[model samples]
Target: MDAGGVDLDARRNTNAGTRLISMASGTFNASIQRVKAWSFADAAKTSPTYDWYPMYGMAVSYSGSNVTSASGKSISSPIAASFVQNYRTQNFKRVLFEYIPDVKVMIDSLSDNHDALNSHVIHGVSNPGAWITFTGDSAIPPGTIKGQAEGDTKKYHIRADEKTGEFTFVLPEGNYLTAGNKIWIYAFLNGKETLTSTIVEDKTPPDKPILNAITDKDASFVGSAEANSSVTIYRVSDHSVLGTTKADAKGNFTLVLAASQKPLVPYLEYVAVAKDMAGNESVQSDAKTVQDTTPPSADAITQFIQVGSSFDLKAKMLVTNVRDNAGNDDDNLSYTLLKKPDIEVVGKSEAVVEIADKAGNKVSVSVPVFVKDQNSSVSKEAMLQAEDFMVKARELPKDETEWDAFILKQAKARAWGVPAGNDISDNIIVTNRGVFSEKAGTYTITLRVKDVEKTIQAVVIPGTLSIKKIPSDIQFGMQKIRSFEQRIKPQEETKVTVEDGRSEKTRWQLTAMLEAPFKINEEEKLPDSLVLASKNMDGNIRYTPINTQGTTPVFQKETASEGLTEIDLNPAGNTGLMLDLMPGNIRSGKVYQTKIVWTLENTP
Candidate 1:
């Protein structure tokens, strides 16, 4: 039987004689030759060789079993077939011969127990051993690594170098590096972590402070320059404290100077210091020096004054030769006028004057003075005289009777205690003073110089004696008499008579009359009883006039008889009389006489 195509089960049960025939089938049959060669080649390389034919034949003869029976042939042939098939089915040619025995035993044992043979064969295969080499380890090296402290998480990346075995990290912009920070490098092989290096960031230093210089000329420092700064000023010579100021948020500073602290001395020195917010101090600027040595001066007034007949005093001031310590003449000086009580000023007589330094620095001052008349004495004297005359004239009496009584008393007092020889004997040189009639006489006084000697003559004479008749026989007209005499005594009486020749009938009447410029005490007493007619036996008179008791005297007569009329005589007369008359009766023979005389009596 050929092992290449033989079934193992059939060969195993074959007779012993058949084992040899099956084992030699490859060398005997030509057609089977190729199969036998293939089987032997496969069996010798893969399975163990055994003397199965001899062993099986001996066992069968000794048992005296019948050789020709179907069971014997079947067992012998199957045994040979099984040997061939086992070699063919093992496929152990790819393996070395040394492992062939192990393959057969595994296959025979699996066949006997009905187990799997491929599992046992695979278990015997050996693994190939290998040796590998790498360029460097994946461990991160120990060193310093630089990185940003505050940056984006994604931007903070680190990498390792293969050649140098060093790691590097990248940081984002605007992030500072700080100390005590760690950098990480990741191994992509197994996602393992490795720290690259420690970081040591640098610390920033503070900035330098700014320095500023401030002077009285430019005292104010404003805007950004004034911010984050401290200023201290000192007098340079003595190192005295001048002022100090702190800058505001906008870097502005303001310094106010007192009046006493102003650099009035001629050559003053000062120093300034400034410090910034970073605690840095600036270098001191150059010393600032100022002088104010000039004295205060006056300034002239700008307004004009108009001078007429009256003199007016105008005030003015002029400032010159005034200067400060810096040789500046522009310093302002003030003045004030000491006013006197009698002086008067015009409106807003006080004024203020301002003067500036050479650099146009200005100051203000005030001055006051009076604007008054210079010649006031002459006008005051003339006004005093006029006022005195008006006061004396207002004290006199206003009534005429009282005025006349006062004048008579003055004349009597002057005439008393006169010597008798002082009166001259000549008719024109009678006593210079006497009771003069104001109504009946014309009085004259004359002064003559004979042989260088002065003599005086006074004369008294009756005025023209003419009778005026009213309502005469020829015409109907009014009669009026105006009487005047240069000489008249005080309280004189004057009388006048009127005669009607028309049989004392025909009713002669009197009308309106007036006596002015003289006080006429009684005017109704015409044809007074003190006078009688040259022949009075006839009944020509009809009425007798009498004085009324306790009545103020009136000059105009309201009641009278028709034929004859009588009038009383009394007059407080000391002046001339003016009478206005009208025609009264219409008759041919009507005659009236205005006669005046005085009654003299001895003094008590």
Candidate 2:
């Protein structure tokens, strides 16, 4: 019946035979066997027991043995069953041992075995109070075992004295010895060593370090280090090692660049890498570049002529200033004078001027000199004399011709009159004496001497009659006229005769009056006695009306006695007259009047 390696499958198949045996024996042992088989299968599926089936099967087969089962089988499954059942009985006894007389005696005998569990008696049975006792190693002791019981398993905690290494426990009142029924104890030496009496189980992991921030050397630029606690800066272009730094207490670190580490060219790029305390690293930050470039400022220079003379060709100019960003005046500025045709050179007879300020700086200005003559004259005395004479002559006469003639005559007179011993006399003189007649006539001469000398001479002359008449107070009328019928006629011609008198040429002009309220008949005819009249040698009469064809008669037979002529009147019964005497120098008060009349047609 040693069923330590018994097969559960064979036991399940034998259920039918066991039922038949049970029926012959009038017992339900077959049902019990079926239930036990089912429990074994369930327990095996839930938490497999290493030797449970073999031990349980052996115990059931040997249950009817007389010598408390065979020693080998008893020691195997039956011993195990007996242990469970006795453990329950012992627990019961321990609970009521003091009250029950038999239990009291039974437990009293087992009291000594508590310290060292041994074989003992119980109520009418031999070797009844069998139990096992446990003591921990030198560092721990046995203790009251407080535990929770489930279907086939139990959880327990052993309470023990820390210093005495002792324990107290109450056994569970159960027929089955569970896997957890064994006494266990725990002890810790300086919280490091593992005690043989203890078992520990844990299923947890350690915590990881968290990164906060990353900063530069001066703490100027910072970035996130959420997963890293350290930083390193590197040259990305060549993967050159720059530097490394550790994170601070707050999981923050700084990265610094060395002063000697400058950009290779105009720009440089750097990358930041971070590693966490847990050895987790992050990708480098995006490359950042800095640029350095500067341009030069504008350069300018100006030059001018020192003296105000012409600047011809390249030799005449001088540089005034040289400038640049470096402000180095010692540096010579290059320049060339351009020959511009439009600019003139001053103080030069033939050439043109050219000047310039050229600094390779490209900014330049040029100026040219102009040449001019500086000779002129002014005669103030001559101009003043001529002007004064002209102004005086203009004021002398209203007529331009008269003023000119008078000026000429005055100049001639002044030329003729030379100095004559301070006495002024005419250049020509003439005198008249009695004339001599020719016909054997006698002549006489008388001469006398006194303070004024006198000389007289007489001679016989021929007889002559001289009638000279001088008209007095002769005046001319000023009138403007327009005529329709008969054009105006010149007035009567007054004649003067001279005979053997002191003869000298004397000229006279007669002035006539214009008679008004006169009219002329259209059909009137000239008398046969009327003749054509003439005045000056030219015979151009000023009294003749303009736009007329025939001459107007001076007198008709009927008006001859009255010395009058007919004149025509306009349709409005009005007539106009004008008389222009020639050779304007006339006597002052010579008066002449004539009455003239005419008949009007009075036609519509």
Candidate 3:
């Protein structure tokens, strides 16, 4: 135990003996050393021994040291340890790494790389483009993450900018990552251990929700969409959001429409949209209409009519409408008369008219009709005395231009008994509906009179057919033309006017022909753009009546003496001979005029 002096026995055991040993090995000042130290006890040996050194050093070839690989795959091999230098040569740190394993991850960078996923917009509606950004401690060179799922592979790694580490990532339009997906980040930098992050994404909109049905009663709507997603109901008529609700896990949703919304009109359409947890909203679904709630229209009925000479008269009842909205199903409606009308009597009869539709909605009304037997005939003596009708002979006044058909009741009533209108009067039925003048002249026709009961009749003196009251002439007023645009209807009178012809029976036709195009000047002649057409009451245009010579029948059969009634020059049609000027023929500063001819003739 003496210093520096050992006997063979002590030397072997203490110096080079197998009892103690020391060894060392390393690279980059990184190494591992093992040693055994021994000391001789003074005499009695206690648990006391020289301070002992347990195994230590840069952690022997740190390998197989791993955590979950960013990819989530169970990966394990070896962790490469490297020495990173700092400002001071002697100051350094060990970075557990594997060649800074390349990963094709888009590092959307701002300041530093971090998973602030909670701050990201769910499915960005306003800013729909999708990608990610972050800041990293060091520049991440471009590289790829090998051996990844088909679509999970990132082929290009994000490279950090020099200082800002600011960069943008733009995904292909249709390739945006969807909601509920996650991005696995595995990054490495000098002097730092591997960095990682898991960002669940919500960048895609949910599928459209279905608008299955809408009811008018409860103002309710129902449909299905993405499970667990929220649904928003909208009134498509105005695109106003009607209500919102959460879909059950099964994707079914019901919406009791908001009471604050305006009352639903008939056939109001409703649509639904879905939103996922990621704030992604789906497009609107198909539309459906609300129920029909309006009731049918009807009015009370009351009437008094003379009974027939033999039996009771059946007067028609009054009804406005009998079915659902717009009465679309009116034809499907059924009616039930609660009570029958009187068959033979002069008394009030009440009948309830019940109207029912396919939707089971019903309405009813009561009609009370009174019947009386007061319709009497002329006395026998009055009918028997009837003879040749006596009428005042009439002569043309002066310069007669038209004639009208007429029947004279000039007979001084032989007995004149029945009701005032039933007394013998002008029997010439033709009144104002017929035109009788082919040419203006003094004309006369015999009059015929008949008793109300038609049991007696007579003939009277001839009567004159002469023009009477006449209407104003046609005048197309002034007009202003701006851009040569739409066609213009001439401001002419609503109807044409001419002299009326008085006659009992006459048949004639009026034809007209328009002159050629209006000549404004030698170099500016307006094309014959005027179209003379007639319209039915419904406003539908009729074919051009002009013949090859521009002559078209303007008046017809109503003027025939066979059924001539009264004097109406233009009675054939009220909305007749309408004229329109086409746009192409319009000039910015020129006016136009043309001559027209009218000819009357007997029906061919």
The TM-scores, one per candidate, come to: 0.21, 0.20, 0.32
**lDDT value for candidate 2?**
0.29
In the range 1-604, model 3's lDDT, one tens digit per residue, is: 1112211112233332232111232222222111121234321233222211111122222112221111111111111211111111111111111121122234331211122333231111111111223222123333443322222343434333434433344332322233334444443222111244444455556777888765556566778999999999887878988879989989989877567653455567888899988687888998887765555556645544355433222322444434355354536466666655563654444556776655566777766544434322233222212222333233322343322222222222222322222333333232221222333433333222343332223222344433233234444555566455433443443343334333344555566675655557656655544445567689885645332355777656554442223323222443444335545555666666666556655553
Candidate achieving the largest lDDT: 3
Better of 1 and 3 by lDDT: 3
Kindly report which residue stretches of model 3 are placed more than 4 angstroms away from their true locations once superposed. 1-106, 109-184, 189-192, 215-218, 258-264, 291-299, 309-344, 350-366, 372-604
Where does the lowest 10-residue lDDT sum fall in candidate 1? Answer: 380-389
- Top TM-score model: 3
TM-score of 1: 0.21
Residue lDDT tens for model 1, 142-219: 223232211212221232333332332222322333322332222221111122232222122212223344434443
Give per-model CA RMSD: 36.4, 37.7, 34.2
Q: Rank the candidates by lDDT, best first.
A: 3, 1, 2
Error of 1 at 119 (Å): 83
Deviation from truth (RMSD, Å), model 3: 34.2
Which of 1 and 2 is ahead in lDDT? 1
Candidate 2, residues 191-246, lDDT tens digits: the string is 11122221211111112222223212232234445433667666678988677776
- Deviation in angstroms for 268 in model 2? 2.6
